[model samples]
Every structure is written in structure tokens, then in C-alpha cells.
Target chain A: MKIERREFLKLGAAVAVGLGGGLTLDVLTKTKPAAAETRTDVAGTRVSSKALHAKRWAMVVDASKFKTEEDFRRVKEACVKAHNIPDFGPDSKHQIKWIWEEPFERTFYGVDDPYLPEAIKKENFPVMCNHCENPPCVRVCPTQATFKRPDGIVGMDYHRCIGCRFCMAACPFGARSFNFVDPRPYIKDINPDFPTRTKGVVEKCNFCMERLDQGLMPVCVEASNGALVFGDLDDPTSDVRKILDTHYAIRRKPELGTGPSVFYLVGGGGAGA
Target chain B: MLEKALSGSRRYWAWIVFLLLLILVGFLAYMRQFEIGLGVTGMSRDVSWGLYIAQFTFLVGVAASAVMVAIPYYLHDYKRFKDIVIYGEFLAVSCVVMCILFIFVDLGQPMRIMNVILHPTPHSMMFWDMCVLFGYLLLNFIIGWTSLGAERKGFPHPHWVKVLAYIAIPWAVSIHTVTAFLYSGLPARSFWLSAIMAARFLASAFAAGPALLVIFLLILRKVSSFKVGKEALQALAKIVAYAMIANVFFFLLEVFTAFYSRIPEDMAAFQYLFWGLDGKHSLVPFMWSAAVLALLGIALLVIPRTRKNEVILPFAMAAVYLAAWIDKGVNLILAGFVPNPFGQVIQYAPTATEIMIVIGVYAIGLLILTVLYKVVLGVREERA
Candidate 1:
């Protein structure tokens, strides 16, 4: 077959687009740290003056004082309800989890005895999607259904999901959940409140994109009695930064190379803080 | 008077009736799924993929095995395979059709699948997978069926058939390679995150796919009085034996490196798969059984005495099919997810509805194969 001018142009465009995508990724990787150095002023922008670290969303959970199951319920209920996660028998359909309390042994990496009632501090700390810096979910999703935002929070395109569930399979944290069945019936209120996911699709925590659009902290943060601290991680002056500076904080599965955005702080028997 | 030879054929009719009943049951089950949703199946959030995906993985290999015939006879010009070559192509046609159907049933909404074609995602491997698989199916059907149609008309085969033959060989290998990449390219799922997965997928596909084709075609040879000679059977069996050796070698390499590397994350999945972690349902039994079957099958094929024995040859082919399916179908996907990343053991089993769909998909495949076989056999026999 003879080559047409349009086909040639189309071929050129394909190559250009391919290279453009590669170039954009390269620029992003290179420009990230240097951009962090140029830290902009939040006072002049739409960001809250009080919420100094507009981008940093971090939490310091003091697991030492938690004695009973009620402590776990209070924090978990607030976190789950805030995100409007559709509850399964106990979990969720696609398991729409924002936070939870894993047993000390499950949470820690390596220790001779992870659960020492007195030494280990048997309180509950909430766990949510890490929203990794280099998320494997985004890498494996064949449909770009799952992606990491420029701001570091990961998001999923419900409509684009082919129900292949590759993202769920790829996540190290068991973070993504696939909608094996239709979710619409279980959601009676229609949650025009939150975006509804379809059956045979995958859904997970989006780090609460709807609230972010309205310029508010995540519902879980607001529900907390100073439990979760949400702010700009890039800015050092944010409340999350102050907390991180004051106490030692840890992330789940730090060795896997998925740089977690959510941090945890275990301290003096504090009430879910 | 001529009917005397064919009257005791309740077996042929019995098989058809049985498969039709299964297809009906499958259709009703599918209707229930469409009305209620995929919830009718056993799959949930944690165990996202179930039996349907497993079957798809297995059948894709079946479709790709047509390559063995194409490679040796077409590329290398082996005369013994001349008769079995057509059988391979027809098997491919039915398998690919079944493979596509299985995926369609697996989807949440079959209609929305068009979006993948309409609004393409080049970055997505699924996009390439769709294009390659669909193209391979059409290419095989047209090239195989059209030549058969020409033969039935008492005409010399078209020159275009030769060009199509050459294209089909590489095209066959690509279908499985691309399928393997669909899993291997994923940066996560340490179990499948290996570099040599694509090669392993191809090797396994060749071994199992042709062995299956031989068994299926041999049945046709016996029942229909089709002259599929011993020479064709022997050549195909030998090809399968070589492919099996490669598959086993790859498995050993994976085991050796995974155990030796001292990486817990990588080794953990394998340990769960073969040895069973701390007494939770050891897949080791299934895997070892598959290994045993494969080795026995290889021995039965490669040795001169075993190859001469008709009983051993067919038995070996069936054994080869079982080994390959267990390795790729049941174990491959489960191994990746077990002892889930949090180090918690998760249990998964196909629900009744899930099993029904699987049965339906197989019945559908057999139905297609039967029709294709009848048509091709009629044409070929008339010519003969």
C-alpha cells in the first residue's frame, strides 16, 4: 500500500506523543526536589493563613494509652464515615478504606516481640491509603484507571476502570479494592454525596478529592479530636510539620520503596491523637 | 447399506446433547449474572480475580499453540506435519473464539468494552492485548478456512495462503508474548514481577497447546475415520516434549534463584505456592503433581519405545494438558496474591455461579470446535 501524507503525519504524532510523555516524566522527576526548595508563600494565595502547610497532610497517632476497643471504634468510625466508605459485612465492597487500626505486629516491620502490652503501647492508630510518591498501582493499571496526582495524592477514574483489577493486585498495602459486584444497590442514599462506583470496577481511597476541591481539610481530620493533621506536606510550617518536628513518626512498610504520604506518630497514651 | 458403519454413534450424539444442556445451563446462569450483577459470582474485593481470569490465561495458550505446527512445517518444512497442520489451525480458530468469549463473560458490562477500542489507551497494555488477540483470531480464521474452502471447491490453494502462513507463525508467538507482558510488566506483584515471565509463558503455551491439539485431533481421527496418520502424531508429540523440557528448565531456574537470593518478599510467594506456609493449604501437592505429570509426559513422548505405544502417547498428551493448566490456570494467579502483602493468609474458592460460567465457557468452546471440525472434516474428506 502507498503511504499517505496524513498517515505519515499520524505516525510522526505518535512518536512525538510517546517522547513527550517520557520527557514530561523525566522533567517531573528532576524538578521535584528543586521545586521543593523554592517554597511559595501561602499568605498571598487561597490557602488558609492558619493552615500554614496547605499541602502537608500528616497524623501523629499516640498508640500508647489505648486500653479498650472503644478507642479503636471512635477513630475508625469517624475516618470511615467521613470518607463515606460503603461498608461490607465488616469492610467494604471495593473496600473503600480511608483509615484503620492494624494490630501492633501487623503494623511493625521487624521485632523479636511486636506486641508487649506495656512496652509496645497497645492503643489503636488509624491507617489509611499511603498515597505513595511512586505508587505501584499507577504503574500497573493498564487503563490509567489509577493515577497519582501532581500534588502526590493518588486518584482513581471509576469510569475508565476495565474491571481488570491490576491496580488492586499491584498495591503492597492491600489498599485498592475491586467492585466484584454492583455497588449501587447497597448505596441507598445515592451518595450524590460522593461519587458512586459501578460493579466489576475497582475503587479505593482518593485522599478525599471532593473536599480538596472545596478548600477544606479531609472529613476524617475534622472529625478527629486533633487525631489527624492535614496540611501541605511540601511546606515545613504546616501543623503536620510542627507535629513531625515535635515527635517521632513512622510509616507502614517503608522498605518497599513506595514513599508513603501518610505518617503515624506513636506517643504517650493519648486519646486517638 | 452404507449406514451400517455409522449407526452405533450414540456417543457422538450423546456428547452433543450433553454439551447443549450445559450451554443452556450456562445461558441461564449468565442471565442471572446480567440481571443481578457479578455478585452472583464468588469474587470479592480481596480476591478480585477468580475462575474466569484463570480460564482466559489457560485458553490464550491453547490459541497460541497453533504455532508449533506453523513453525516446523511451514518454516522448517517438516513433511510429517502436513496433515496435522490444518488440524492445528482449526483448533486455534475455536480456541481463540472461546478465549474471547470467556473474557466477554468476565467483564462487568460487555457493551462498555467497546470504549477500549473507541477511546484507546496506548499506555495501557490491555489496549495492545485486545488488538493483537483480535487480529490473530481473524488472521487464523481467514487463512485456514479460506484455504479449506478452496480445497473443497477442487481448486489449487491461493498464493496468498503462503504469505498468510508466514505471517501467522510470528503472529502466533506474539499473542502469548503480549499476554505475558500484560502480567510481567507490572512493577508490583513480586511473584509475576520477573523478567523471564514472557519466555516462560511462551514455552508453556507451546508445550500444552500442541499436546492438547494432538489429543483433540486424534479423537477426530479415530471417530470420523479421518486419516491423521502416525507420522503426524509422532512429530507433534516430539515438539511438545522439547517444549516441556524448556518449561521445566524455566521452573527450576525460578525456584533456584528465588530460594538462593535470600529476599523474603520474593521468596514468600513461592514458599506459599509450593511448600504451603505454616500448614495453610499447600499448593505444593498440586504443583508437584503437575511436575510429575509433565516429566512423565515428556518421557513418554521422547523415548522410542514409549512413543511407539499408542496407549502411552495419548496418555502423555492428556497428562501434559493437566500439568500446564494447573501451572498457569489455578496456581499462577493464586500464587501472586496469597500470603497477601500484609502477611495475612486469604482463602478463595470459585462459587457455584463462578463455576457455572466456567462450565459455560468450556461448553461454548466445545460447541464452536465441533461445528468447525464437522465443516473442515467434511471438506477435507470430500477432497480425499
Candidate 2:
């Protein structure tokens, strides 16, 4: 078997190519069944109950109804309690926030005109993770730890997150928080249902996917009375769709092309008007 | 060859011991950081990346700078650089090791570093950066080791070695370019989003990398029998001077575009760095110092008399090295986050622990460099 150098090299290259191709095919095929199952489950659930299955989750906050500080506090408190987010107190430099308050101007800085209504200008808007259709945080995450779920909710897999904080840097809204310290000690009352995060890894609002699975509204939405509305944006009949259709609403940094799901209703003015 | 590093003077042993002590201190600090979290550092939610990342960015430039010597020597057959090219490669090897360490320490979950490889997101610049950095490290190691061995044997390097060296020329440029892309592609941070980022990075790297190389050669001349020669040093000085000029020019261009446009978003970071933005002026003094030093360094190098004077040359190189380090390693990353996405200034200063960790990484790089230089010099001496 006298094989020339050129022929031998050609044979080696072919074997390498064949092995690489076979390995790629194996990897693709192995993951297909799990993905297919999730897809089927989503489709089956959608067919069984139109109201239960979310194609795109979204939220709307009515600034007019959220008049008092107490009203805003309740919504924040509910979210914090539901998520087991640590409270580093008022003085802590690096506090964890699943939901927090920001002035209206700061919340929608670029969009807001200088001639904004005085009432809207002074109001403290409750801001949280927007769960965008095109999320920069998800794009920058090396691990798909923070990802968009089938329901269009941006989900955080705390266990899988390497806590690189690239997502924190990538999030335009400052929506994500890193567990700079052990979050467990700071958490006053641990939620038995929700697991507390470790000293590393990022955490953010998950749109209450767990609660939704149990046929409950997001804790923030439930606490907001009629101020906060949550529903499937893909469903034409959903409350969020109806509210968005009928009212004048704004999403944060829409120009950034993130397609934020959280909308603000600033139409019914009080002080400036 | 391995025994060469082991047989060194008392000064060499002392230097090695000093680096070891620093490494021990850094290891202890890192242990504390591991037990807690990245919270031990001064980085916050607003300023997420801090000292570690900044150092990583700077060292990557230093690593990429090896191409300055490699290109002139290998591609152009520039005889002057032939003796010193291996030193540049060895310096790159050390810089890369430090860069990798800086990144590892910066990670919130250092144990899960392999997730980057397992997940392999093409969309993420970090994924690409990891690929290039590791590839560049391996390429330099193979080329440096193989070429040096061939030189020792008085034989021409294998054909494959030349092919790898050619591949390395473009690969060096790509490493820094990819690093710039990591910041530039982000839409959220207006300060980093610029077309000139990669170009600016390359210019700075070419200046800083060779400056360090020249400094090392000068030290080697004094302590050892290794002669990098007068012509070699002068040629390297020319490269450093040109690159430094280009780097400063690129930075001035950034300043002009930002201030002239008067887009508050664009000007915010520069304003924060040079002046005080919203009363936060921690970085103001350092940035000014960097600018002044850079100008003075360029002035010294541009003048032939000052550049050629051996006594004046070291000072000029040191000034350029410090200026570039301050600009890239300290100001650049910090300023990018300032006037953060929400147009607010949240100041960050590295903790004692963080600084110690940085010092430790540097010590490790120096130790690696010293050992590598010792071996290469020994081989060359024996052959001579």
C-alpha cells in the first residue's frame, strides 16, 4: 500500500471533515427531541385554553391610578416579597431591585419633552425589567442563563448564570442586579416558594412566570389594583392589548429598538394640567 | 534550557521571591473575594465593570503589540529586529497570561468559566474574544518555542513555523479589533459606540507594547550579556513614537467629535473624564496627568536628539507606558460607564483587595517574562 504524500493528505482531510460533520449532526439531533417536546407542550396548551397560554407577555402601568406613595410601595413590596429579592436598606450602595422607583423624567429621559406636564414630571414611575422582544441583555449573556421564554417573558435561569454581569452592563434600563454579596443574609423574610439567589449571578423580574403557571397574576400586577395590567400582547382579546389600543402609552427607550413590553399611561394628568 | 532560569544571580532570585510574595497576598485576597462575591470590589450596578476588566483590556493591547516586531522582522526581513523579536513574543506570552488572570478574577463565578466554551454564543463579542485570545496565546507559544529551538540548533525554522508566523500577523490585529468590538457594538453605552474604537485600540497597542519591549531590552543590556544593539532600539523607538502620535491623534478626534456635535450623550463621558460631570471629579486629575504625560512623551520621542539619547530614551518610554496605561487601564472603562445609560454619575474606586489582586496578576506576568527571557538569552549565548 504505497500511498503518495498528496493522496495521504487528501485522505486525512476527508476523514477529519467526515468526523466533524458527524459530530455536528449528532449534537443537532440529540437536542431536537427536548426542543420539540417544549414546542408541542406550548402548542397543546395554547389549543386547550386560549386565555392561559401567553404568546407575548406585557404590562401597562396607569400613572393616574398610582396617585399615592402607598400605592407604588404596595406594588414594589409585593414584587420584592414574591421574588425573595434582598433589601440592602436605604443606605446600601449596591441594593438589589426586582422593581424600584424612578422619577418620570429619568424613567423616560430621552422621550420626555422639556415641556412635560408638571404632574407627570413630578411623578415617581415604578420601573422593572421590560422583558423586551429584542433584549440586549439576553444577546450579551454568554450562557443562555437569561433568555426569552416561549411566552415572550425574559426568564432568568439563576442556576445556570455564571454571574459575568455582561447582562447587567447590556441592560439599557438598569433593570438587572448582581448579587454582589450573599443576598440571603440581607433578605428579611425568605419566600418559601421562591429560591433565594447566591452571592454571584444576576437576578431580575421574570414577569412572574411561576405565578402565571399556577393561574395567578404577577404579585405586582395583583397589588396595583387597576393601575398595573398584565396579559398576552399576542392575544388580541387580552387586557394589555385592549389598554394599549384605547389609551396613549409609552415604552422606555423605544428608539433603542429593544421593543420593551412595559408601557406607561401618562395621559390623565393632575398637577400640570 | 529549563535549567537556565534556575541558574540566575542573587538579584534575579530576589526578584522572583518578591513576585512570589505578591502572588501569595493576591491569592489570599482572591480567596476572600471568592467567599463573598464581586461586591468586595467597588463596582456597583451602574458601574458593573471596573479595574479587572480595564486591566484585561490594556494587557490585550500589550499582547497584540508583538506584531510590531514580528511584522518588521518576519515579513519585511528587517535584520535589526531579528534579535529582539523573540523578546516581544515572550512579553506577549506574559501579557496574555495576566490578561487571562484578570478576566478570571473578574468573573463572579470563576469556577464556571468553562460555560463560555460550552455555550459558545457567536452573537456575544466575549465569546469571540475568548477564542482569539486563547488562539493568539497558543500561536505565540508555538512560534516562539519552535523558532528559538531552530535558532539554537543553527537550523532554519520548519516551513510550518513560517506559515504560523504569517497567520499570527493578522491574528494579532484581530485580537485587539475583537476586543474593541466588545465595547463598540453595545447600543446602551453611547460613549463606547464608535466606529473608530478598533483603530484607536490598535494605535495605542502598537505604541505601548513596543515601549515596554524597549524598556525590557535596556534592562537586559545593563544586567546581562544580551545585546539588543543600538540600531534595534532606535528602530523600536521610531515605531513607538509614530504609534504614540497616532494614538493621541485618534483620541483628540474622539474629543472633537463628541464636543463639536454637542450631543450631550456623546460628550458626557469625555466631560466626566476631563472635567467634572455632575460634581463627580475623582478621575479628573488622573486624566489630566495622562494627557500631559502623553504630550511630553510624544515631544521627547519626535525629536531625534532626545529620542537617540539613551538616558532620555528610557524616560520617554516610561512616560508613554504610564500614559497609555492610565488612559486605557484606568480612564477608558471607568468613563464609559460614567453618565451611565440614565445620565447619572456613580463613582467607583477599586477596593484594597481588588488592587492587591491586580498587583498579584502583574507580578505573575513579570515572573513569567523573567523566566522566558532567561531561557531565551541562555540559548542565544550558548549558540554564540
Candidate 3:
């Protein structure tokens, strides 16, 4: 398509500004590597190589192991407490759920059959940000505030977000949440470690990058008692890769071709059918 | 030049005063929204967009409608539209202003709206939309002002102005197409994801814009001595008829594909819009009314006798205007959200504050129209 001279000039200006903003963001987010330190566990054993960079982060939740509502609630509480996500209880319209529960039918909505077994149909699955390889939210973000990191984690820069809600609309999984009102008042006990979001900006699960940086597993994974697997998918030796190779796990809305990193192992044959 | 608009009758001043009052009330409501956030309005996480974005979508078509008059007068040398073309451009100018205001008010971080400019992502359709809208606004402003100035001076319009007019013809189509692209490209909303969205948008715009123009021109004819001849109105009615037919046909194409394919995701939105999915029928009556009105409007305009009749022509144009409005402004955006990603219904209805802001925005548009028309009429009357 041939653009008029004036239109071209306007576009040029926009590109120039975009480049400038990109440089600024890079400078602001650049962090020191924490002096290449090694950490020891409580029993004085090395748990992980602290300086090792994850090539691709992924999560796999075994649905059968999450048998009780209390099991799901513990995971939710850990994520919420760690992230300082506000509680807007029972008001679904205003509620901000980073990771929440859904029925098996709703979780695997389009793929699931109507006449599935009652036990399978009644199962509740814990859902969160899929951290898609090709995230629609990142693609549609006007400000680049929501982006897919090199580690296959979809990240949000709340400070840079313009609050257009475009990311919220673009997320097909409904993973993103907009702070419709000031979230501070509703937050009963703010976690000092995590920063709370202001009203208007969109937010979602960030795969707990902060916890990972400190050589710790994500709070949800820790709370799940071996039910949830978290590891570098790029590493063939990682726990997630091992599980994917052995088990039949499905990602939500895989037909959309987003290539979601989060996988679910429902175990009982007809859960996906 | 602006002094001419200032020198108007008592009725003109009264109208301006009324618009100012509405604007004041809207401003107050906006202040409240600014403090609290979009939660002050009816918009939820499910329905992220509501009245503000809807009006923005509708008025973009209104702004682009000026092309209907411009193309006939400038491109085809249709002299019948000569006197009224300025009004069309002026209407477009006002509508564009209103469109900008709607977007501004809809923004969560209104202050950071400049980020769209500061950190533009060309991949984002919204960024492209912003560029084209601002460009279109500038094009209309320059074309309308220069042409009106040339007319006031009693000189032949310059060669450059004609070139710009030609450029504007396609640019007008691009503005609406780009606006449609803003919705269509999103894979998240099945209701908006379609190849024909831009074509459908242009068809609806071609009908709605011209229809609104005709109604405004008829009103001008009664209130003032600004005469848009019978032949001109008839020709416009014909354009409206054909465009409305295409628009309705495009909509039906969507319906046919959704139902025939039996794709649950594709059919879900339409079901929510027409019959209400899972007991959510908020937009059901409105969608049905718009469909009926569109049919009636098409029938009225398609018949030559009714189309040519002055009294009936206004009714026909009104029907076309309201039908397109309800279709685009009310049904389109809401349907995109219902059965949201999780396949659940979350209803949305605008609060009083939201409604008042909409009214205020319309009043602002009318106020601009009144002032611009006053200037155009004064210049024409002096020449006469």
C-alpha cells in the first residue's frame, strides 16, 4: 500500500519515538547479576546453580493430584500473597484473579465433550497465564508494557503500562486483569516484597520471576506439594520436559496456535475427550 | 472569518448555550471517572469497552461520511452537491473532534495516552488507528478550511486543493477500514474477527454518514435559507439505499457463515447478540429493533415514489441513521465481549454518568456543526 508523504512522515515520527522508548526501557530494566553468588540450602546442600539462566520456563499441573478444593485454594493463596494481588471478593466484575479455578469442562472448553463422565466433568482445574510462545497480549500491546521475555515467560511492566486495556481484550484465555478501581483499598495485608498495582493498568501472572531470581521455586509450585512441575523446558533434562515426554498433557486452547507453555495432565483418559 | 459565526440569531446562541451546559455536566462526570477509573462507568473486565469506545467507532464512520459528498462533487463534477459539500466536510470535522474526545475519556490512564505516540508499536492496530485518525482529521481540516476560504474570496479553487480532495476520497475509506481493522485483527474476539469487517464497515459508513448528512441538510433548509435542492437529496437517498442494502447483506453473510459452519466459538457471539446466550438478553431487543429498522429503511429508499417524496425521504434517512447507529454503536462492541473468553455472560449497562458523557460529547459535535454551518451559511448568503 502506498502511503501519502504526510502519512509517511507521521509514521516516521512514531517509529523514532518508539526506538527512543525502547532504549530507555532497556536501560531502566538492566540489572546487575547479583555478584555471581552461590546459595546453600538449610542443610548446607547446593539446591540449584544460582547464576544459571533459564532458556525456557514452563509449568505442568497434574489435575488428579489436586483432589480437594483446599488443595487449589492453597496454591491460589500462595500466588496471591506473594504477588500482593488485591482481594475483591465475590464481585466477579471487579475481581482480579491472577491464577484461579475453573471446571474441567470450562478449562478445556472447546475440546471437551458434553457427555463426558460425571467425575471428569465435575473436576476443577487451576488455570493461570499460559505464557504462550506467541502471546496475543504481547502482540497487541501498544506500549510494549506486556511482552514475552526471552525465557518464554510473558512479563508485564506495570510502570510502563498506559492502561488502554488492549492487552486484557487481546488475551483469549482471559488471563489478564485490569484494575478497574484503585486496588489498594481492597488489599487487606500488602506484601512488603511485592509491589501493588494502581488502578487502570492490566496485570497477570508473571511466572514468579522474582522468586526464580532468588533461586527459589514459584510459590504455587512449592504449595502444590510435587503436584505442579516447574523447570526450563529448553533443557531436556528438566522436570517439565521429562513429564511432557512421559505423560499426555494438554494446553488450553491449543488450536489457537499460541503454543501455551503451561500444560495440564488430567490423567483419566476422557478428561480431554 | 470566525466573527461571522459569532453574528448569529437568538436561536443559534440559545443552542450554543444549551450545548455548553451539557458539556459542563459531562466534564463533571469525567472528573469523577478520572479520579476513580473506568469502574465509574459500566465497563467490566469482561466487557472492557463500553459506550465510549462504541461512540468512537460510530463517529469514525460519521467523520468518514464526508467522502460521499466530496466524491460526487469533486471527482465526478456533480454540481448539484456544490452548495452542500462544505456542510458535509464541516460535519466531518465536528464528528472527528467528538471521536477524539470519546477516546480521551475512555482511556484509563488519560495522562499516559501519549505513550501510544511515545512508544508506538506498529504491530498494534491501535497505534495505526491513532496515526490514520489524526492524519484524516488534519486532511479534513485543511481541505474544508481552504475550500471554504476560496469560496468566500470568490476565486476558482486552487489546483492543490483539488489534488487534496482526490487524496481525501481514499483517505476517508482508509479511516473506517483501519478502525474496523482495530477490532478484526484481534484473535480474541470471534465476533469481530472476520475478513469482511473492513468491507462491512465501509458499507455501513457509506450509508450512515450520508443519511445523517441528508437529515442535517433538511433541518438546515427549514431553519435557514440554506437550500439543498430536491435533485441533490434524491441522489443522496439513492446512495444511502444501495449502501444500506450492502451493509445488511454483509451482516447476513456473517450470520449464515456462523450458523452453517456450526463452529461453537463463531456461533456463540451471534447467539448472545440475538437470542442471549445462557439467559443474558440485555442486547437482544436492541439488535432486533435495529434489524427491523434497517429492513424498513431499505424498503422506503428502494421505492422510487417514497424516495423522491420530500416528507417520506426524511423518514427514510432517519430510519437508516438510527438503524446504523444502533447496529454499530450498540450491538457490535457488546457482542464481541459476551461469551467472553471463558464462555460466560457478563452483562454491561452504562451508568448515568456514562450516558451524560455520551450526550455531552454529541452536544460538543453539534456545537461545532452549528458554528461551522453558521460561517458557511453567512458566506453563501453574502454571495447570493
Candidate 4:
């Protein structure tokens, strides 16, 4: 079992080289440090100095202000363009829309109203992920593919999603969409900035997290012409809270206790109306 | 035991060949689905899950049904089930294998399936389901093989085998209960959201599982030297009858609750399944047929003369099997997704490719069942 001096030196050299290689590998593989404390980039991506920060990001939709189909279309177009969302033609089966419109009756089905305003009923309300305070999708995801950030946005990591579609079933708003087919083929013009998903993974609105990192407002909010307001629910001075304070706001399926961040300013008496 | 399965009669080999062909076809269909995407199936964004999930749900119950035989034999020391208990365990092994396969095939990213384990999220029922289903498969395979081997060698099985059997009884219940929770825990799906969902799942499972066992037993009687006694068949039929009645009772209770409360959310899915929601009636025919067959099977099983009649029992069991398949296998999962949370009625039907793929999975299950059953019969025949 005794080792010669030459053999001992050779083994020592091998051990030293192995240790040095391992240390170098560890440093190389380490994730890049955050740009700053104020604005945290999600995936080691660059964040602009003037990036938006929120304790809990929220969106306030004044459905009453959405008067025309063009208003809805423009906002939807902006999101589609920014996100590189696929168009699965008109068929609803394989369709992958991050943000879309539903009629007033469907959007506010939980808010019972036998005698609602005809104008409100006629309008198509834009719906996306509610990003619930107690998000079921996050709770149900086996791989944490879909998770809620500190800012209260329910973010999806498409690469990690095993595409079991449990999150799709868990969402009450029908916000999530599965990539039934390869989404790359359907994208008319792919946005290189935002990542496009492959087939078999579930996807939904990320509330423009990357844009927030770049100090840009959500494309839908910027496009809506005052119909959609994006702000921090936690901040009292935020637009969402100010609007909540001034006018009564209703959330979809509030009874379910998901505590949705998205609020609808439907004018009359909110839920009672 | 392995040698017993390898060598069989012309009919057995022919059956094996048929299953292999089906499996080959199914693998090809699955490849296409893998290449193109889940779009090859009839599933949509609205009906996020289709045939694969439904079959997974159904087979979980079937796999759990092995407990029906295991319990009476192991717990109650029911001597009648002693001769047939191995058959039940083997059946479970096959069904559990199919159950795992169904879940694997249903995944959008099947390759990343290890992620379920890689990053274990205990909060997710799926992770727990993965644990329990695999655990159940292992328990059954070990118990069935060891017990059969011990019998062949003319010795009592080890005490650890009995301890495992005890663990399996509750473990069996957990596999189906967790599966029921996978649906019932979801707040969005009102149809599946009920206090009695687990109970209903157990009831249907008890009915479906034993009825299937009876059919397998009858088939064994015909094709091989394996003979499950008339008393055992009758006892199993009684269990099936009681469970089938309970299943129907649970359905009626749900109907009553939904209709009485008149909560649109609660009633919407039921309306979609039984009648048509927004003029969409794709599931109505299937649902009605399930109802009628369920009632018919219950009546036949309850009647003493019909239950005692060997010729009639198989037909009655078949009715029960088909009815449960329609209700739990096809409609339950489909109806849960109907009205799509937006209250829109979107119809879904499986494609030919999807059906072929399903057939392939069943072929795998049957192949396992056939080989396992062959070994059991071989051991018994050799003893005789």
C-alpha cells in the first residue's frame, strides 16, 4: 500500500489540476450579478436604469372607456406584436392568444346583473391573466414552470414547463393557452427580444416583465389610450389604487378568493350594478 | 415464471402478435403526435385535456380496483379470494403500467417529465400522484411476483410480503383518491368540485374494477385451466352491484345539488353533459347511454337469478364496464372542461390517430395482463 515519492507527486499534481479546473468551471457557470438593487432582471437580462419597480404590479381596466372595437383591436395588436404571439387562424382549438376579448356577460358572469346597460353588454372586454394574489397555477405547477414573482406577476418559464396543462385547468379566467403546435410557424413576424415557445407547453400573459425591466409600460397599457391603466396595487400613490379609491372596481370571480390584481372600472356601482 | 410467459399455445402467440402489432402502430401514431404536437388530437385550448387524461383517470381506478380483491383476501381472510388474489395483483400491475404510460403520453413535454422529480413540488397533486402511482406499481409487482414464486416453491411468503399487502390496501385507495383530488381540488371546475368526489371515484372504481376482474376471470375459465369459483364470482358481483348503485346515487346527488341550488356554475357542466349547453350536444348521447347501461347493469346484478346465472353475469359485467368507461373514462374529464371557464360550449372529439394511440396503450396493458395471467395459469396448471 506504500506509494513511491514520484507516484505521490504525480497524484498530488492530478488533484491540484482537478481542483483548479473545478473552481474555474464554477466561476464560469455562475449567473451574472444583478445590474442594481432597484430594478432586478429576471433571467440575468439587462435592465435599463429607469426601469419600473412595483411592490405588486396591478392593471386597472376601465371597460367603460373601451367604446370601439378598434380600441380593443389596437391594444390586442400591440401585445401580439410585442410578445410574438402565434396566430392559429380562426379555429379556437390550437389558438394561442396571450390577451383577448370576451363579451361583458362572460367577463363579468359572477357579477349577476339581470338588467345591465345594453352598451356595456355590447362591448367586448379584454381579458388576460388576473395574476392572483393566491395564484392556483403557481400552487399546482409540479416544476414551478409558472410562478409568482415578488412583484405579484405570475411568470411562466417556458423552458421548464413540462406542459401538463394543470395550470390551464387551474386558471378560472381561461387566460392560459397551450402550444398545441409549434408556435414559431404561426408567428407572422417573430420578435427576437421576447422568447417564442415550442409546442406542448402552456403559456399565458407575463404582464410584460421584460418590458418593465426596460422601463417601458406594458404594450397593451401604452396602446389602450387610457382604457387600460398599469400600476402598483401595493402603492397607495399608484394609479390603480387612486382609481380604486375614486371609483368602485370589480374583479372577476372575487368570490373564489384568488384576490385578482386586475380590476374593472365598470362605472355604475361596480359589482352591485 | 418468466419462462412460462415466453412459451404458450398457438392462440396465445396469435394474441401476443396482435397486441405487438397494435403497440407498433400506436408508437408510430405517438411519434407523429410528438413530432407535430398535441394538435394531432381533438384537444383545444378550451378542452385542454382529452382522451389521454381521461384514460389516465379511468385506469387509475382500474389499477386501484386490485384492492377490492386484496382487501377481502388479506384483511378479511376471505378464503374464496385466495386462489384468485394473484390474478387481481397481476391485473393491477398491468393497469398501473398503463396508467403511467397514459400520463407520460399526455405530457406536452414528455422528455422533461423528470422535472416532476428534479424539482419536487409537494403542493402539486401531480407530484404526489407520481409518487403514489409508482409506489403502487412497485408494491403490486413485488407482492404479486414474490407471492406467486413462494406458492410455486411450496412455501408461505415472507412476513414482509404481508406487511406490504397491508400497506398496499391504503396505498391503493390513495392512488385513486389523489387522482380524484387532481380534478376535485381545482376551484375552477365546478363539476369536479364536490366533497363527495373521492367517494364517487372509489365507488365507480370499486364497481368498474371488480366488474373487469369478473370478465377476466370468466375469460380465464374459458381459455385456460384457471377456474375462479362460482361463489367468488357471485361475491364479486354483489360488490360490483353495491358500488354501481352507489355511483349512480352519487351522480343523482350531484344532479340534485346542482339543480336545487340552481347555481349556474354548478349546473352549467351538468347541462352541457346531459343535454346541450349553447346548442352543443356532443356528449349527450354518450352520457345517456352511460346512464341507461348503468341502470341496466345495476338491475341485472341486484337480481339474484341473473347474478347467479354464469351466462348472464358476464353480459351484466360488460354493461357495467362499458357504462363506467363512458361516464368516468370519457365524459368526466371532458365535461369538467366544458363551458371553458368563459361559459362557452366548445365540443371536443378524439381523432382517429388519438384513438389508435389509445388502442396502443390498451394493447400494452392487455399484453402485460396476458403475460402475467399466463404465468399464473402456468404455475397453477403445473401444480394440478
CA-lDDT, candidates in order = 0.70, 0.85, 0.84, 0.87
What docking grade applies to model 2?
medium
How well is each residue in B1-384 modelled by candidate 2, as lDDT tens digits?
678889888998999999899999999999999998898999998899999999999999988557999999999999988888889998999999999999899988888889888878988888899999998999998898898899989998899998999999999999999999988888788888899999999999999999999999999999998977889899999999999999999999999999999988889899999888989999999999999999999999999999999999999999998999998999989988877666689999999999999998998999999999999988988998
**lDDT over C-alpha atoms for residue A267 of model 4:** 46
Q: Number of the top candidate by TM-score?
A: 4
Cα lDDT tens digits for candidate 1, B1-384: 122223336786787788989988888898888767677876665666667777888888988657788888778988877666777887888788877877788777566777677667676666787888888888888877777777778886698987888988888888888888777865456778788888888888998889898888778868895767787788888888888889889988888888999777678778887777857765788888998898888888888899878778889999888999999888887777766656665656777877887898799888777767767766666577
Summarize candidate 3's per-residue lDDT along B120-169 as a digit string, tens digits.
Answer: 89998888888888878888778888888899899977889889888889
> What is the C-alpha DockQ of each candidate?
0.32, 0.51, 0.57, 0.67
What is the interface RMSD, in angstroms, for predicted model 4? 0.8
Colliding pairs, model 3 = none
> Which candidate, 1 or 4, would have the higher DockQ against the true structure?
4
2 or 4, greater by DockQ: 4
- Candidate with top lDDT is 4
Q: What is the per-residue lDDT of model 4 for residues A86-171, given as tens digits with 9 covering 90 to 100?
A: 88787658888888888888897766476877777777788999999999899899999999988899999887899999999899
Q: What is the lDDT of residue A246 in candidate 2?
A: 75
Candidate 1 lDDT over A21-89, as tens digits, reads: 321111111111111112113222121122222343444455553445666677667545544456666
**What 10-residue stretch in candidate 1 chain B is worst by lDDT?**
B1-10
Model 2 Cα shift for residue A265 (angstroms): 1.0
Candidate 2 residue-wise lDDT, A148-234, digit = tens: 988898988777788888888788898888889998988889877778888788888988876665456899989988788889899
| Models, CA RMSD each | 9.0, 8.8, 7.3, 6.5
Write the number of the candidate with greater lDDT, choosing between 1 and 4: 4
